[model samples]
Each structure stands twice: as C-alpha cells, then as structure tokens.
Target: MNLIQGYDPDTLRELVDERECAERLAEIESQRSLPVLLERVWLLKVLDRLDEALELAEETVRQARMAGTRKDLLRARVLHATVLQNRGAHAAAAQELAHCANEAEGRGWFGIAAFAHQHHGRNAYEAHDFDVARESFKRSLFLRREAGADDTELEKALRAIDAAERRSAEAPGVLV
Candidate 1:
C-alpha cells in the first residue's frame, strides 16, 4: 500500500471527510506494517470509532517498539496519546504528550516536537485549561518555526494560540 498518499495527519484533521477516511481504512485493512497501523489508528479516531482507535493505537505502539525505529516509536506514541486525549483521558494524554514533546525536542526533531506540542495544546484546550493551551500553542509555534514548517502549519499554530487566548479571556474567574 502506498502510505504517502492519504495519511497526512494535518490533512486528515483539517478535512475530516469521514467517507474518505472510511475508504482509506478499507484500503488499508489488511496491512499490518507500522505506517499502516498508524494510519489505521488515525482513521479510526477521525471516524469516531474511539474504542477501535485506542486498541489499534496500543497495538501500533507495541509494534513500533518491537520492529520500528525510534522515530517510528515516537510517532506511534504520539498517536496513542492523541487517541487517549480523544477518549477523554486528558491527564494521561497530557503526560504522554509532555514526554513526547520533550524527547522530540531533545533529539532535535523539531517537526515532531511541534506536532506534539500542538496536540498537547489541544488537549489542554479541550480540558478548559486555556492558559496552558495558549502556552503550549506558543511553544508549538516556536518549534514549527525552528523546523521550518510551511505557512499552513504556522498559521494553524497561530490560530490555536489565538483561540486559547480568546477562551481564557472569556472564561469565568480568568483575570485576562
């Protein structure tokens, strides 16, 4: 299976075309490679099949640990954490993503680090911790710039920060 065509996480999230995801999932159903597993995890998550997503995410992590490279393992873990976040295990997701972001940054994988920080910010945003979300989003923006990400990515980070700031300002008992 060609893993490059339809598995971009950013595109998946931005478009959120359920039929497209379902078709892709069907196409990849028999593939058990790490990349395919990762794609499956994301597809399931986006399709709102959270239980299946979490299960496949856990399996993907295990497979990455056994056979994939460190970068692959980190990518698997990030997806696993995102599934956790989507499943409402906010604290667990935050902890996992914090480790991921730190590890990615330490290894100078700025693109991966930015992705982790961006999702970490999303987790905090969903939990209504707007301050943390804004801080994380800002960090993601910095990391994205460090990675020389494209304008689309940078704009997404900027938008996330703005959203967090707006939420913080509108929240009750928030000072600003």
Candidate 2:
C-alpha cells in the first residue's frame, strides 16, 4: 500500500503496517520528484520521525511552489500544515489550513477544499473546539459531495462529524 493509504487522512494517524511504510520509503529513497517527496514526508511523519518529516515537508513545499502546479502547492501546504498540527503548532496549522481551504474553494478545487477542511476539523478536534470541528467536518462532507468523492471519503467525513459530536457531548460545560 502507498504511504498515504497507511494513515487516516482526517486524523493523520497510522492505520497500516509500519514496516510497509519503511519499505515504501526505502523504495523511493533515491527519488526527488514532488510526488516522491510528498510520500517521504508522509512516511516519516507516520513513522514518528517528526524532525525528518518537518524538514522534508518544508522542502516539499518549496519544490511544489517552485515547479509544481497550483494544486500541488496547495497539497504540499496542507501536508505541511498537518505536520505543524502534529507538532502541536495548532494555531499555525489552523491558519494555513483555512487559507488553503479558501483558496481551493475559490479555485473550484472542491476535492482539495474538502481535504483542507477535514484536516482543519481534526486540528480543531485536538484543540477541544468540537463545534468548530463539527462545522469543518460538515463543510468537508458538503465539498466532498460537490466533488463526487468516493464512499470512503464521504464516510470518513461522516465519522469525523460523529466523533466531534461525541467529544462535544463528553466535555464538561461545553455546548455544541
């Protein structure tokens, strides 16, 4: 499986074999393509090598900005924001994701918008802002529908909403 397939997109948590990720990383170690770089960033992140992941993510963003398409740049930015979120730089991640989502939406890139919203939702969820998380997830779901996203994507968005709802209900004195 691909490095991305090894993680849950919304949560950025590993969902498959770590050895598989290692093998994939090894397989692509000699590559410098944007796609390869992106996969390396993801594999390093999932493997808990945050330092390497962050460094590679930044390089990937630079590469995407310099030589890749707008969609590629946005995707790189989103992944960079995710790494920031994972590193506990929640505010920075939120700002970057919001910008990415707005840009993607303005450009009619509904799929990317959905991805940004989903990750933004996860950031909010981690920060204990369940209402924001739920709203973001709802927006993601809507965007995914607009983009004709597959069932797996839609279901993930739905699950994120449900999780936010549950968390909101559990938190003391929080009204969602």
**Candidates in order: C-alpha RMSD to true structure:** 4.0, 2.5
TM-score per candidate, chains pooled: 0.90, 0.93
Residue 76 Cα positional deviation in candidate 1, in Å, after optimal superposition: 0.5
What lDDT tens digits, residue by residue, belong to model 2 across residues 1-176? 54445445345355867888889889999999999898889888778888899999999999999999999999999999988988999999999999999999999999999999999999999888999999999999999999999998898888889888988898899388
Worst-scoring 10-residue span by lDDT in model 1:
3-12
Query: In candidate 2, residue 31 scores what lDDT?
Result: 99
C-alpha lDDT score of every prediction, in listed order: 0.87, 0.90
Which regions of candidate 1 are displaced past 4 Å?
1-15, 174-176
Please estimate how well model 1 matches the true structure, expressed as its whole-model Cα lDDT. 0.87
Candidate 2 regions exceeding 4 Å error are 2-12, 174-176
Residue-level lDDT tens digits of model 1 in 1-176: 33233323322233466777789999889999888899999899888899999999999999999999988998999999999998999999999999999999999999999999999998898898999999999999999999999997898898888888888898999386
